[model samples]
Target: MGIKSSLSKVFASFVLKKIESWKFNAVDAQERTLQKLIAEAKNTVFGADHHFHDIKNYQDFKERVPIRDYEDLRPYIERVVEGEPDILWKNKPQYFAKTSGTTSGVKYIPISKESMPEHIKAARNALLTYIHETGNAKFVDGKMIFLQGSPVLTEKHGIKIGRLSGIVAHLVPAYLQKNRMPSYETNCIEDWEQKVEAIVGETLHEDMRLISGIPPWVQMYFDKLSEKSGGKTIKDIFKNFELFVYGGVNFEPYRAKIEASIGKKIAAIETYPASEGFIAYQDSQTEKGLLLLADAGMFYEFVPADEYYNDKPTRLSLGEVEIDKNYALILNTNAGLWGYSIGDTVKFISLNPYKIMVTGRIKHFISAFGEHVIGEEVEHALLSVANEEGVEITEFTVAPQVNPAESELPYHEWFVEFSKAPQDLAAFSLKVDLALQQKNIYYFDLIEGNILQPLKIRTLAKDAFVNYMKAQGKLGGQNKVPRLSNDRKIAEGLKDYIK
Candidate 1:
């Protein structure tokens, strides 16, 4: 191993020990974080308006702050964007993470100086934790590539504004600077397709070991590499490539196809990151869930997913969360977000160290006929069946086909892009439907009551999703198709690409 790799193992060991010290006291660490956040921003406008001075405990906070989405918090965010100081948090925010919002259009999530380090630290710790557990720091000596947005930033009222990944690109640790791939000039390319092409050209022969991105984009790069290299597997192109780091979407759906592209099983780490905060990461290769970052500069609250739309949903602290129940995640961050609902639903699988799995989006579900099916359920159902049948799915989405052609029973329409089609598609669909019914009782009841028929799969053309996203001008960089939708907007758009 090189000097850098040898020293990285030492640093990884130290970081792992520090993480171990606090992970066991997760609940207490969360309490301390809440207290510190309140103390630091007490005099700020939002803090004062929300009675932060009078806040004494989690109860006080629950009573004072109401759960809000981006639309609800737009007024305060507008003030900040218009150069208002101390409106949300103490002083001015260093940057705004610009993201596309469904209802609010453009969302500018503040990234305060105090909170910025948390994002960097959590990401670093994820890798370090891997190295500490596996005793594999040799990847640090090889080229690493993170498929991401351009590092270019725009100014909104003197605060830098850009995508979270783009902003993070500017903050790559100095130690990894030399090992990071896809030259800065190539990284700055605006178009994603062009960027990938440029990246392929630059890193094709490099000693790449660590590759990170949302799954689909990485797949795109791999596809291009394969095409350029006369159908060679990714493992052939980069023999040293060992780790795959991914987030933003469930990796299960793409796992088979991605592994096929790589030509082998490889070490992978899952992460749960968002514009709001770095929430969790896979702490152990053997563990089932991502470890919630309890000591990160954020306090978490959970409202049971079923109760999320209710006027008075039960807002529970970290300590109150139960295993296996889906909860709408709420955040109170040092970045000045108070009781902010990032619209994600998560299920706690482990409580000892507080590990969770991203279940779905609160807004992203299919319930046209009152059979509320979530992202996780659909992904689980399809992936389960796919694995059993040895099938490879490229991408898929589910929407209720409430208005099927005359006299046909209503059913869920599954738009699936398959890399390897099942010989018995009807059988495959039946297995998937059965799996989904087992997971959701409502869906089972609906099917049994003749209210809904078994889901029908509509095979999509090659690169259908990519084309759909490209047509919508959201081809890359953290954008993903919703796994389930109540309405047929996406389902309709996908019709053009049907086989």
Candidate 2:
């Protein structure tokens, strides 16, 4: 093993001790983290207003600060952006991580130096924990290709503004940068297609042992490599490849295709990372859910998913949570975001180990006709059909057709881009419809009562979603197709390219 690999192994051994300790006592750890954050920021503008100094416990904290989304905290964020001091954090924010916004064009999230270590540490410990459990640290001896946004950051109000990946790229440790793939010039290419093509060229011959990216973009690179090299699989080009570390989106839908591209089975790691914070990661190979980082520099609160959209929601702490109940996550982070709704919904799969599976997003749902359908339900139904039919899905989205212009009732429209189209498309559609109906009673009722027409399917041409996203200037990285929309906006937008 190389010197770096040997040292990393030694460090991983040390971090394993910490992770094991934190895993079992998640509730206590989370309480302590919350206390620490309250104490540290007690004198800040927000803290003073919320009476943070007087807060003695989680109950006190909840009562003092109201749970808020980005819109609620926009005034404070604007102050910080205007170069105000001690607005949210103790110190001025050094950077802002730009991310996708719902109504707004872009969201600029504050990133302080104090909170940066948590992002770095959580990622490092996740890998170490994986190695500790699986005993698979050999990949550390070779190169790691991190497919991220351009490293060149854009500046706004004298603060660096860029995608989280790009910000993370600038923070890559010197030791690891030597082993990282793709030159700086290649990563700076703004167009995703051009950048990925250049990345394929630069890293195709390197001794790449580990690869990390959002699954769809990684799949694109894999396809490009296969086409250019005339090889059956990615393994043929990069023989030393061992691990695929992925985040941002679900990996199950892309798993079969990824494995097929590699031409062999390889170990994988999943991380729950977002612009708000690095929440959890897969800690053990045998574990079903990613272990939540309870002590990782953020205070967490949960509101039952159904109640999240209500005027006043019930907030529950880590100790108050139960397994299998979907909850929308609320975070108060070290980075100055107080009572921030991160918008993610999750369900605890393992209470003993404090592990969770991300279920969906709060804003991303379809409830056009009281048949509320979530991202998780959609994903599960699609995966179920894909598995049963022995086919692979490339991508898919669902939008409600609320009006029937012709001779039918309003119903859901499914636009699917299939990597391997099932031999019988109608049969596949029927299975999907049935699976969805079985999962959601309201949807089933709508179908049974004939108030809604049968779900319609439109098999999209190849790269249909990709072309759509590119046209919107959101082709890659953290950008993703909204899986479910309540209106016909997304469905009608995709109609032009429907086959």
Candidate 3:
């Protein structure tokens, strides 16, 4: 091993020990985190308003602070935007992570000095854990690229404002600076297409090993490499490439297509990151779920997904969560977001060390006929059938078709983009329908009672989702089409691309 590789192994060993110490004591770590957050923020404006000083336990917190989404916290955020101090956290935030919201036009999520390092540390430890487990530290010496938004920042009242990924770009550690790829100028390209092209030009022949990004954008980079290299697989172009790290979406649906592009199966890591916090990361290659970051300067609360909209939902702390149950994730972070709803739903797969799988968004589901099928269910249903039928799907989305032609019953419409179409589309559709019925009992009852017809599939033309997102000005950079929608907005928009 080279000098860097040797140093990496030693560092990984050290970090893994520290991780083990916390992982085994997850509940205690979480309790300590809550106490620390409460003690530190009690002097802030929100703390006083919410009676944080009197909070002594989880029950007190639940009664004192109400759950708040971005809209509910907008007044405080607005004041902070106008250069106010100590409105949320102890002092002014170091940066504001700008993100596009569905109802709220734009959101500015604070990144306090205390919270910023946690993001970097969690990401670092994820890789370190991999190294310690698999003895694979050589990738550290090769060039790495993270497909992301423009790193260019705009100033809002002295706070740097940019995408979460872009803000993270500014914080890449000094040790990895030389090994990181697609020069700063290339990363600053506002247009994603041009950015990918530039990235391909910069790293096409370099010793690239680690490629990290949300899957679709990484797929775009792979496509560009294939085009430039005259259809050669990624393995052929970058012989040293080994690890694929992804976040923001589940990797299973895209797994077949991505591995096909690479021409081989490779080691991969999944992470759960958001503008609010870095919640979890896959700690073991053999493990089923991402290990929750219980001590990462944040405390978590989980409300049962079914009861999320109710007046008084049951909020459970880490020790209270159970395996295989879906919950809407809530956060109280050092960044000064208390009882904040980030809108993502997750399920605990392992509670021994608190591991979870991101199930879907709280708002992204189809329940027109009371089925309430989520993102995980739809993806699972399709993937199970696709694997059996040897089909390769590029992308897909589900929406409730509440109305149909005369004499026809309403059904769920699945818009699918296929790289490899199945031999028998009808038979394939039936299999997928059966799989979904098995996963969701309500949907099965609806079909059996003749309240709705079997779901229908609409094959989309090649690059259909890409074109749709492009038209919406959300072509890349953390933007993704919802896997499931209650309304026909996306389904209607996708009609033009139907084959």
The parts of candidate 3 lying over 4 Å away from their true place are none
Task: List, in order, the clash count of every candidate structure.
Answer: 0, 0, 0
State each model's C-alpha RMSD to the native. 0.8, 1.4, 0.7
C-alpha TM-score for every candidate: 0.99, 0.97, 0.99
- Write the residue-wise lDDT of candidate 1 on 347-398 in tens digits: 9999998999999999999998888899999999999988888899999999
Question: How high is the CA lDDT of each candidate model?
Answer: 0.94, 0.87, 0.93
User: Candidate 2: where is the Cα deviation over 4 Å?
Assistant: 155-158
Q: Candidate 1 vs candidate 2: which has greater TM-score?
A: 1
Error of 2 at 231 (Å): 4.0
For model 1, the superposed segments whose C-alpha errors exceed 4 Å read none
The TM-score of predicted model 1 comes to: 0.99
How far residue 31's Cα lies from its native spot in candidate 2, in Å, is 1.2
Candidate 2 lDDT over 1-499, as tens digits, reads 6777678778889988887787899899998899889998999999899999899998898889988888889999989888887889887887899877877557779988877778888888878877777777778878899888877787766778888888888887787888888888998899999999999899878899999999998999999999988865888888989999998888888888889999999888899888778899988777689889998888899999999878789999999999999999999998899889988899999989888999878888889889889998888888999998898988889998877688889988999888888999888888888899998999999999998887888999998988999988889877878788887788888999799
